[model samples]
Target: MRNLTVIIPTYNQKDLLERAINSLISKCNDEINIYVLVNNTESNYIVRNKNYANLHVEYLNTNCGFCKAVNYGLRLIKKSRFIFLLNDDTEVINQIDIDNIIHELIEKGNIFSISLKMLKGNYPNLLDDAGDMYTILGWQFKRGNGLPKELYDRPCEIISACGGAAIYNKKILDEIGYFDEDFFAYLEDVDLGLRALMRGYKNLYYPYISVLHVGSATTGGKYNDITIRLTARNSIYVIYKNLPLPLLIINFPFILLGYLIKFIFFAKKGKGKIYISGVLEGLKNLPKFKEKRRENMRKKKISNIKLEWILIKATFEYFHQYIKRAFYTLRGAKK
Candidate 1:
């Protein structure tokens, strides 16, 4: 068995998939195996491994979105010690970076997940997202997003996981679960981090392991209908699945208020209907989502403290700054 398996789940990105595959081929040391999961009917690239060994491809029959495609592909891999997830639009920019991540994973032993620094494809030097952060409203946001590249250098612990280029312990994941099939695509990483964190496992960010991602190249970018709906559904479903009854009570108001603000923003962009539909559909589907949560939380062997800490640690302070700024602006205007 290989020390690690790099799994890239793809859908309809025939243009960039070859570059992504080549990127992996360039970086992976002999210790890891590369697995590509493709679902789209259009297969673009072919891999001829004369120089490199341990690289494999598993093509699916239908376009099963991303979550199912990954899970489906994962089931076929001979259960390796580590499973690294990289997106079809992302490329490993550095080889030493990947080596460091594998080193950390092996040394840590109990780490459930580790995310790498993801930079935007347009501005390869500028930071796209450092890792994933959880917000108080029970949502995940990419850290250091839109910030200058020079600022994000230190490795740290993150509350949530980033699926763009994250490595997972396969054994732990199989028991905890794979990506929630209901999530289809977006927010699945956040849901997985929440579920795993609830079990006392560590999810971290290794800044040294950096990669570049062409954001939304395969899926939604600014805000399309499918992205809107799944994100909306999963956002509400996340709070339902992870938050306790009391935290849930405290979180509802903020969640609604956040959506209200988002609605106005979407309206300004002429996509108001899309956001509204997502919110409404998410609300309508809450009961079933809640039941899913109830069933999932039962499988964990962690304390409620760790669960709450997951929320607190994963909490992104950036939004708190914006909210604070907004409140002060309102107060100053009143004064």
Candidate 2:
């Protein structure tokens, strides 16, 4: 069986898709199968492109959003033991030795996924995402984002792996479950990773494997209405689904504070109303969320304290970054 199957999901970005496909084709060996899910785009667009000749293309008639697109691609592949999820806006920067990585994963038995170092496309010297970090306050952030690349040169455990450029053990995914389609887009990776963690699976951040990502290529660049809405809504779902009832009761205050702070921050960015709308939408779907939460609870293998230990706390550094960003934005506005 082939060791790796790379799944790239694209919405309407044909040019970026071509670049991503070519980069993977050049960097990866022939043993690795690449599947491109052309979601919500006209069939003729892919059919006319000769660039897709070497890659497997699965065309979706309707715009099913990111989560569904990935799940669709996963359904199409059968043989590969490891599945690598890549965003269509990313380019493989180096030749990733799949055999070595697979060996490492096998040796590490508990690791469900390995988060690859994602460098910024515009500034390769800076890091885009080292891995994903989750906090007790029901928030998720990309670790080492905008930091110097050398800062995160060591492998470590992370709360989650970014789906943009992460390798997952296919069996674990089958066990824990695929990305929640209800998420539609943002925070789905965190939701999935958290589920894996609750099921006794670990996620690792491997610095050797890297990719350049042109983030927010599908939705308008970060902090836009669409992204703000989807992310805010999904955040609620993630917290609801993963935390047990007792844990949820204990963390409710922190969760409320987090959402309040986020509302104020996004409001300053002129997305407050949109963000609130998403939050309300999430609350409106509580019945569905509760049902899913019950189902997820059944798969729990770890204690709440153990899971909490893995998550980070709301430290001064976290608030400090936001303060700095707000300061910079105000300064830029004055100029």
lDDT score for residue 331 of model 2? 76
By summed lDDT, the worst window of 10 consecutive residues in model 2 runs over 46-55
Error of 1 at 79 (Å): 3.4
**What clash count does candidate 2 reach?**
0
**Candidate 1 CA-lDDT value:** 0.74
Q: Largest lDDT belongs to which candidate?
A: 2
Q: What is the TM-score of each candidate against the true structure?
A: 0.88, 0.91
By TM-score, who's the top model here?
2
Model 1 lDDT per residue over 196-270, tens place: 777768788777767888888765684777777678767877777877676667667766776777778879888
Per-model C-alpha RMSD? 4.6, 3.2
Off by over 4 Å in 2: 47-54, 313-335
Candidate 2, residue 160: the lDDT equals 87
Residue-wise C-alpha lDDT for candidate 2, range 1-335, written one tens digit per residue? 27788898888888888888778777765556778887877544762336444467888888899999999988877877889999989989888777888897645588899999999999898789988888878889888777668878999888789999999999888877799898889999999988888888889999997789999999979988899999888988888889888878887888889899999999998889999999999888878877778888987999988876665452343565557556755876799
- Screening candidate 1 with a backbone cut-off below 3 angstroms (N, C-alpha, C), the clashing residue pairs are 159-314
